[model samples]
Target: MDAFLFQVLAGLATGGIYASLALALVMIYQATHLVNFAQGEMAMFTTYIAWSLINAGMPYWPAFLLTVGFAFVLGVLIERIIIRPVEDAPVLAVVVVFIALLVILNSTAGWIYTYTIKSFPSPFPKEPLFGIRYMSAHEIGAICVTLVVLSLLYAFFRFTPLGLAMRAAAQNAQSSRLVGIRVGWMLALGWGLAAAVGAVAGMMVAPIVYLDPNMMGGILLYAFAAALLGGIDSPMGAVIGGFAVGVLENVLGAFVIGNELKLTVALVLIIGVLLVRPSGIFGKVHVTRV
Candidate 1:
């Protein structure tokens, strides 16, 4: 029971990372029908920026804020300059463009950062939280932070005016445009917001995983599984799915498959979900009239 409790706590901590990224994925998917394949790479790029700031004497919190801001602007620019042109194109075309972006960002980060792994510092102290035997301060702190972020996001989309506009725009751009909503700007805003969220995930996970240009690749896979498991279009589902995947991965990896086959676990879950319920656990199925 003690061992089981420890794994559960550890899973929650690791799941916070997936939840953050999955939230980002849900945000973009909500606004645009296409998924941004470059989302992880974009997060990696901003994390590198944060690292540079910290290395240059900036405080960790300040560096984190600046990196998030930078990521938002970069996301907006990418949407305007790159994605906008392809917005009306076929889905395959947009996906290819996103793939191009993924390759470019990955190569750029590797070139700039030299493909070296570095240690990242946690803002939280390296002690147990409130003397809890099952979890460290960093683990508890990270899980709390992820929950807070998700709550704020829920409030934003549920109560804010801009959030309403964004929702309106996503549901029907033609109708939104006819009603005088700036659909393009709303889409750009979604990208910016998603980028900021991804930046947060990158910062949170870096300390545990170590920092590198390619650190997010495997993490992204888990996040993808979480998003798909919960319902790609639901942020709440994403968070729940993240935690579920995290715990499932921890238990299965430790007891059944071993750590070496953990990636296969994610793959199996994704395939199983798709085969059993393509709309996902919480996703709504829409029927169209011919």
Candidate 2:
């Protein structure tokens, strides 16, 4: 029972990480109706930035904030410089551009930081708090941070005028533009926010997974499955899906198939969901009018 409880806690921690990244994916999908394949690589790059800042004697919290800011700016720049030109291009062109962006970010990180894996520092103490043995301090801290982020995002979208504008733009760009909303800028801002969220996910998971250029690859896959499972068009659904996938992966790996086939589990889950319910648990099916 103790072992099972520990696995559940650990799975929640991992789920928080996936939830953050899935939120980012859903953000872009909602605004542009496209997935950014480079999202994980972008997160990996920003995490490396945080690592460098920490290595340079900055405190963890400060470095984290700075990296998130940098990621936002980087995301905006990418949208303006690369994505803007292809915004009206065919779907294939947009997909190719995303793939190119992913490759470029991955290679650039490897070239700049090398392919070496580095240990990331956790803000939380190593020892479990309150003498609890089931969950570690880092796991607790990560979950708290994820919840805080979700709350902030909720408030932003629900209360702030800017957030409301962004939401409107995403829902109906043509109508938003007619109503004097700058739809293009809203989309760009959405990209920036998504990048910032992805950065948080990377930093949160880095300690457990270690820091490397390819570290987010498997994570990205899990996040994709989570996004699909939750509903690509729904932010709240994405978060829920992320947690569900995390628990499923951990429990199944510990008791059923062993850890070796964990990635296979994600693959099967994605395929099964697509075949049975392509719109996902919370996703709405789209119907195009002729």
lDDT of 2 by residue, 122-211 (tens): 999989999988888999899999999889988999999999999999999999999999999999999999999999999999999999
User: Native-vs-model 2 lDDT?
Assistant: 0.94
lDDT of 1 at 232: 91
RMSD of each predicted structure:
1.1, 0.9
Every candidate's lDDT:
0.89, 0.94
lDDT of 1 by residue, 1-290 (tens): 88888888789899988999988998899898777789899998898899999999999899988998999999999999999999889999999999999999999998988887998888898878688979888888889888887888888989999999999999999999999999999999999999999998898888888889889888898998999999998888899999988888888888788999999988998899888886678887657799
State TM-scores per candidate: 0.97, 0.98
Model 2 lowest lDDT segment of ten: 1-10
Q: What TM-score quantifies how close candidate 1 is to the native fold?
A: 0.97
* Model 2 spans > 4 angstroms off: none
**Top candidate, metric TM-score:** 2
